[model samples]
Target: MEMVAAAATKDAKRNGGTPEWRVTVPEGASVTVEHERCLAARAWGWLVSCVVALGAKVSGSGKRLWKIGADDPRRAVHGLKVGLALSLVSVFYYTRPLYEGVGGNAMWAIMTVVVVFEYTVGGCVYKGFNRAAATVSAGAIALGVHWVAVHAGGELEPFIRSGSVFLLASIATFSRFIPTVKARFDYGVTIFILTYSLVAVSGYRVEALLVMAQSRVCTIAIGIFMCLAVCVLVCPVWAGQELHRLTARNMDKLAGAVEACVKDYFADQPADGKQPPSDKAEGYKCVLNSKASEDSQANLARWEPAHGRFGFRHPYEQYKSVGAAMRHCAYCVEALSGCARSEIQAPHHIKQRLAGGCASVAARCALALREASSSVAAMKTSWALDLAVAEMNTAVQELQSDLRSLPSKLVEEESPAAVLDAVQLFTVTSLLIEVSTRIESVVDAVDTLASLAGFRSSDVEKDEASETETKVKQPAASDPDSYEPEKKHIEQV
Candidate 1:
């Protein structure tokens, strides 16, 4: 067997693309081939892992595709609008007269529709107007530069051209750093730089400069106007509407994550003594990721007009505070999650008492967030928000009280393990208090948002009617066996 193994190694090294692997065994009778992890075995493991990763990738992509398809059944409306706009522009160049009349620059028009077009009509409107403004302003400046360079002539012309490029590039680069301009006029800034560079380098003669600039601007404007028309006139997709919806969805995800975290903190172990991935822990990141979407959409939404009768100027100021509140909520969740993750040995009795109160408070907190999401979605502020917040405040206070009231016997134990458990419990309780405060901020922010969006008492009442039906289908909050069961136990603490 040793001779055969030696021969196998020699043959493998002679024929191999990969470096040689030689097996060595103990000089005893314990040799077993079954334990060997040879090339075939390693290859099989690599193949399995690759297959698993690919399957997950494909599955995730499919689910995302389905959502995109189902979420907007009328997406084809935007597609039709795009196609129609493109075809109309195509007809201009297709004809002899109109193409010449429009300066014979079909690429400019076609590219404008393609670049200015977006999934949302408001996005197109915002980008198109910005692009045209940038182009015109850049064109005007370029023509001026051309005039100066032409009149200067010879050696001076090259120097002047270089100076103009450097000046414009430096100024534009610096201006893009400012927050407001960066948000709304970022695309414009980029286009301005591109246009200015081209004009400076193109070396247009004095006589042809104006004509060239005019043709470029005209073609771009036609494209912009065409795109704007199609977007507004043909099944417009409003960015503001989508922004509001996205914010609500984000709130809902946060609520779900809160619920999952609370459940996992006190969840029972598997029967086999192994722990599966906790649903709540998995949800923690979802709350964090929602922040980016909220920010992007809100900025874009501000550029949009007051559509769907939500009123003008849209109180974007409120989102800034709400985001602060949401971030606070996220930090509290992280702290609480950290506590649950650490292994702290506590007496079973103490564990039971702490968990019961903690669960009650957390569950109510989750409900409050879920309600907040629903209120924002319907554009109806909840009357119960104040009450729910009060409940959380009270529950958190009582939980603290209960923690303070942990049996006197625990004090006598004086064990380091008991001390760690007590410390962990306090840490988690403090996080809950912070969570309650942040939830209040969220509730207040949403109320202000609803009011700004033109919500009234009547709107709340109308929305509540539908929500009441939804609530009735589920168990009552006051039901004894429900998740909201008898806060009475914690109340007495």
Candidate 2:
């Protein structure tokens, strides 16, 4: 068998193929062969596993992408709008007459579209305006400097050009550090620096500087027009609308968090030793993280023109105040959440005493927040909001009274362990009161926003008032006896 195996190996090697070994056992026994085929099988298995893993990864990425588009179809529309803008701008390069007009600078239009087209109309307009202004202003300055440098003689021309570039660039860079400039004009400053540096440096080697600057500015203007047209005319996403919706949504989330926290704190624990789900209790965390989004939306909203229910000078800044108030309330809600989850719980009897009052305050506050959200979303003030807020204030007063009565009860308990529980309960009650206070601030901010934005009075309020008046008059109309005295008195007068 050894000689046969050695011969087979030699034959396989001589044939320039993988070597195979053959082993012979006793005549009746089953024969088995181990060869490179096993290695090949292992390699195939590894390759299959790699392919499966790669497929899974690709599938996961595809699902996430799909989810993004599904979550907001605006993303897909924005993408199409971008494509349309780019296509329109590309006409400058594709059409012969337009190509002759801009010459070789047509690429600037394409580049401008890519850079300026944004998710929202206000954002696109903001960037487009900045780019156009920066390009033109920077070009004019660069041309003036170039003209001066050329007449200064060759020796001093380099110094003049380089010095102007350095001085202007430094000033522009420094201006970006200012809060107002950074908030409103940071992009403009950046573009100014880039355009000025490019035109100034290139001016040294390129003659006909005026024509070059003109062509670049014209192409950029063309691109800006295309972007503005596409963004505004087709499925525009208004930054003001986004800010309004976000502010309202945050209020709703805060309301849910407040109600959830109070209810969870006073809830009876399950006998199965399972913890309750905390998804609603944690809703306020989103409100806490929304400061940056609110600020960005407000800033961009300022650039938007009057559209839909918004005016030319909508109170974008007031949204920030609303966000601030919500965040304050959210912080208190977070504390309430912590108290709910704390191990040092108030005695069941004590909790029972305060539960109704706490729940009433929470429910009233939540209702007021929801009403406020509805008012903001509808761009109208509602009687419902006023009523809800008034109820919340009443509930808060009642809760305060209930809290005042708790001290005597706690003193009666007087146990050391019970003291800790009372302290925890006090912390929760204090946070609840603070949260209610902050909610009032939020409501006030929304009211201020409504007034500043010129929000109309809701028809629902008017209809209800009219209905009440009709009911009051109908009784007099139907009951002739009630109207007879007034008619006789008027006749005598």
Candidate 3:
């Protein structure tokens, strides 16, 4: 190998090129080949691993999607409904007759379906109506502007058209900032601006502006109609029902959080003396984040027509009131939860001393909340709601009395740490009291909703009425004098 290398170097110098050295490794030849083979094997292994990992990720994603569809079959149904609507609208492009009817503007109908179709019927109706009305109004204004600009001749025509677009667009955009308009007709205003701008700008060059506007409006109307039909006729999810159900569910969750916070605060510590694992219930947390959902649902619900158990003019606004009250109570609950998990915990005996009163207040409050929830869910006035609120108030008073007597106990404690713990205990108690008080607001809101919505009397009221009637008809059989009076009264009637 040395001799061959020296010869190659001399040959490269004579040729005026780079040196090239070659060696024969007869003994290590198989090992060198084996090393190369090992590297190749590793590369192949890595490639296989990467492919396997990708396949696994894809499979997992697919399973998650399948699980989501399975969990709420309604989502799957909604997807199918959208596909069906699009397919039905697509016929305008596929069939010659339909194509001739709307011309190439049939694309507008497809676009409308894509943009307007929603999971809930109310949402679809809301967007569809806004789009259709905006298109027609904008188109009419556009055509009139175009006609005037054309008659004004070439030089002044451009200014007239530009000025109209700027004025109308600015007015429409400014209207969107208003509260009422922003809430309900914001989408309409946006559509109006888009339609007006498109038509107005295009009219500068297009000769047949009227025919184009007409075709587009007709196509959009067809799209809107298809969306409404599918949304209403198929598995329609009513926004009102969703809002109603969501409000009731939040009340139930609030009740659970109140009761759980009180119970957890008074619960016994483990023997090991370590703080128990934090088991914060998510129920009240959900209430804390529910404001936006409530607002959107209420807004969408207003667009919904009269449906099962809901009147055409049902007081959907009242639901927001109920939600506001709930969120307030939920804030207090969240504070109590933090107090429960605070580093300075009240002494066990102090907790014991206040436990009964606090538990009673919490229980009564939870009971009242549950009654209100049941009222909303059943769409009926709760017969026992007033009684429940009264009991809750009484419990609150008792808790207050207990709190008034707590200072003496705290004063007796010699250790400052013990006093601090008592202060924490008082904080928790005060929050509970505040929560109990706010629960009344929640109940009142529900009562107002029940009255405005014209909810029927609950089953409990009917049962009580039937019981009273039976008692009245039975007469006083044990007392002959009362029986004769009752019999005489009945005969007279």
**How far in Å is the alpha carbon of 340 misplaced in model 3?**
1.7
Clashing pairs in 1: none
List the pairs of residues colliding in candidate 3: none
By TM-score, the candidates rank as: 2, 3, 1
Q: Which regions in candidate 2 have their CA more than 4 angstroms from the true location? A: 1-35, 270-277, 410-419, 459-493
Taking all chains together, each candidate's TM-score versus the true structure is: 0.74, 0.86, 0.85
In candidate 1, which residue ranges exceed 4 Å CA deviation?
Answer: 1-68, 71-81, 153-155, 203-206, 271-281, 343-348, 407-409, 412-422, 458-493
- Quick one: ranking by lDDT, best first? 3, 2, 1
lDDT computed for candidate 1 = 0.75
lDDT per residue (tens digit) for residues 371-454 in model 1: 787777777665676677778888888887887766454667654456556665566666777787788888888887877766
Model 3 Cα shift for residue 236 (angstroms): 0.2
Candidate 1 residue 242 Cα shift, in angstroms, is 2.2
Tens digits of lDDT, candidate 2, 1-493: 6789789989899989778777667653332334456778899999999999999999999999999999999999998998998888888999999999998999999999999999998899889988988998999999999999999989998999899989999999999999999988899999999999999999999998899999999999999999999999998999999989998898888889999999998898566533364788888999999999989988998898888888887889999999998998898898898778766576767677788988999999899999999999988997889899889889889889988877776678665465556676777777888888888899999999999988888876688899999887776556778788799999999
